[model samples]
Target: MYTFKFIPRENIAQIIPFLQILDVNIPAETLEQRLNEMFDNNYKCVGAYHEDRLIGVSGLWILTKYYIGRHIEPDNVIIHPDYRSRNVGDQMVDWIHAYGKANGCVASELNCYTGNTRGQKFWSSQGYEIKAFHYRKMLDNEL
Candidate 1:
């Protein structure tokens, strides 16, 4: 089993180049801004590194209803293409689930593009159900 460590945003600069190699295209300035916001907002961000190279990232955000609330939620999950098929995604998700459980979340939600069959299958295999369906149409702004 490969060891996974949760690195903080302070070290995120070191991972940006690796994440870029994975085709993650967010600008460094944008990423820095986001990282600062996450830290200031008390959210948790984790990166999985192997031998000083970041191979995966999971961004988590806690959600609440104000009246009725959940303690934890995961916002994003991505594993480098080269690291796929080795169970890194599964392990990272499992870790996030455990974090939610520990924080008393009743449920966790993740949004994936409708046409991403691989993502749908993966989430299904991980025991997530299709609880809701949404349809949208662009009203305008086509150029």
Candidate 2:
């Protein structure tokens, strides 16, 4: 059985392992520092637990955009490999939706890698449709 809770910043460390599973290339210390910085900027994390151990996590950022108005954007969603195919991700998504509505968000948005067909399918099942392409470029030197 799994339980869901809004994790506080101090307990954010508990999410490092799950985050690593999603992006193994990130250094642990860098992830920790970044999470802390996000928390300082109003980012929130919700976690799924099984028998007192965190097994999944999702991070949310509340922001206002002209296209969507006030919205909840979820990032860094992950479920431990051991717990996949058991609806944990669905539950987290459900929780995020409810939370977004309760907090006056007009919409919820998330980004999924184009290659992650399985994840895209799941998001589609949850009523999300692609609206735009996200682009990024890494700077080799300070601007």
Query: What TM-score against the true fold does each predicted structure earn?
Result: 0.75, 0.92
The sequence of per-residue lDDT tens digits that candidate 2 reaches over residues 32-79 is 889899898999899989889888888999999988899999897888
Error of 2 at 48 (Å): 0.8
Name model 2 segments beyond 4 Å from true.
141-143
lDDT of 1 by residue, 19-93 (tens): 454345677776667678877887666776667667787668878766437855555567778898889888888
- What's the residue-level lDDT of 117 in candidate 2? 88
Best by TM-score: 2
